[model samples]
Target: MLVAVLATALLVGCSPRSEPAPEVDVTGGAGEEPSLEYTPPLTISEATSEVLWEGTGPELEDSGPVLLDYRLQRADDGSLVEETYSTVPKPFTLTPEVLSADLHEALDGRTVGSRLLLLLPATSDTSSFASVMVVDVRPTRAWGEPVEPREGLPAVTLAEDGEPLIETPQGDPPRSLVVQALLRGDGDQVVEGSTVTVQYTGVRWSDGSMYDSSWVQGGPESFDLGSGVLPGLAEGLLEQTVGSQVMLVIPPESGGAVGGEEDTLVLVVDILATSAPAPDALTEEG
Candidate 1:
């Protein structure tokens, strides 16, 4: 999901591929040293993106979601098309299927604080334009410390990226819900009433069976970490930091959001990103 309101698909005007690639210079733009520039060929048949500055931070992954502050301009008349410089960067998934083939190339091998210039020439299927993107490779989620199992509780394990592997333990289900952090992160803390993007999987501890998963649903989901969600999820996600993976083992009392009645509910949640509370929410509190 795009940050700063709904993901926008606004294109004021389309630039024809008839003209040569216009000269683009990001000199003194957005706190970056204005040293990067690119000029397009008069005629082109392919899409291309080049990194203006490979940020000095850790290298970013070729796959996964990435945040970017972007500025776009039409090549024909050099009119500003769109931008995210004033607001929070947008979250864009990096898979070739989620993004275009050429877009993946631009994000590939880039460092977290990198800057890039993508010049997609005219194509039979798409329009032509120049886009300047400042990539902010945020921290990836990680598995935290393991939670000690209670007597007769189900066993849980996680894959490298925080996917859970469950093995049901034989005994009566615990009477209350359980929430644990499998991994800890160093990002800003998640307080009550925050909004977040999370990757999660839900299952039944009774049979070690799967119920729902955000990963299988094509991507993680973004929502306010408040009453708008299931009781189990709302409570389970509370007070976790961004980039931390948590596990929630729920009983009937704390599992109403997921329709738990007789089954023992288990959830593995990765708190991927968090955003500030809405202005309206702040106003209401004040």
Candidate 2:
């Protein structure tokens, strides 16, 4: 199920109290499933959060999508309600409209790789029981072991947040497709006809001018490898692993042209996640 935070309850006014925030013993490191230990029937007077561990990654500065692994529990009896750690991590936008005021305030200005503990008091609108949540911030970009590209390729540099900056080489673009891995990942290999989540920057090879970018678009994008994508892009991404950074040099014949005009395209793609198409989806494509 999608994670949803109700704001109406968070906005309810609270009276001042002398009691400190309830103690929630969180046991686990970042990137792993966490275990929560606390007394049952806990009572909270206000919404509060505590940073369990600090992160060293880039600071969040925008409302872009932030990936998170979290566990939510019922505070009245300490029973698990929902969690993402045993499965896939979920991405949430850090906007007031998307998250509760308390959640937004707690997550805002925080860096990636941080873990936080949140307590929400019972509200009349949604639930009569309080809620406890443990959140682990995950990186929004590709991260893996760096690999050096071969000579004569465009130079690729990274910003503090892992956004790729591409510099076209000094000669004519390659005649055929070129796929080079800038970072090697340890995840599963991307297969043909699968869906992929990626952050990418596309630029014209002739003058190094950018034409498209997922970073500029505010977040990563998901694409189906079976259709609606350039032939060169699909071919280059096949067999690549998740968590990898790849550079693809596409010639004009491979859907690299702009407005049917001959132009090579240089793309730096970060392979973040991939999943096989559903059985019905594959049948429909077939």
Candidate 1 per-residue lDDT over residues 55-138, each given as its tens digit: 665565556656555665554444556564443345567665555555566667877667766655444334544333333344
The positional error of residue 70 in candidate 1, measured at the CA in angstroms, is 5.4
Q: Encode model 2's per-residue lDDT on 1-286: one tens digit a residue.
A: 4434445434443333467988889997755689999999888878777888889987876677787777888888998878865444666678766665667788888998899888888878756778888888877788879998999998999997789999866797889999999998877688877778788999998889898998888777777885879899999999999889999999988889776667899999988777665687769768
Q: Quick one: best lDDT, which candidate?
A: 2
**Best prediction by TM-score:** 2
Candidate 2 residue 201 Cα shift, in angstroms, is 0.7
Model 1 / residue 58 / CA error / Å = 11
Model 2 alpha-carbon miss at residue 274, Å: 4.3
TM-score of model 2 relative to the true fold?
Answer: 0.75
Model 2: residues >4 Å from true position, as ranges? 1-28, 35-44, 62-65, 74-93, 124-129, 186-195, 252-262, 274-286
User: Where is the poorest 10-residue window by lDDT in model 1?
Assistant: 4-13
TM-score of 1: 0.66
lDDT of 2 at 55: 94
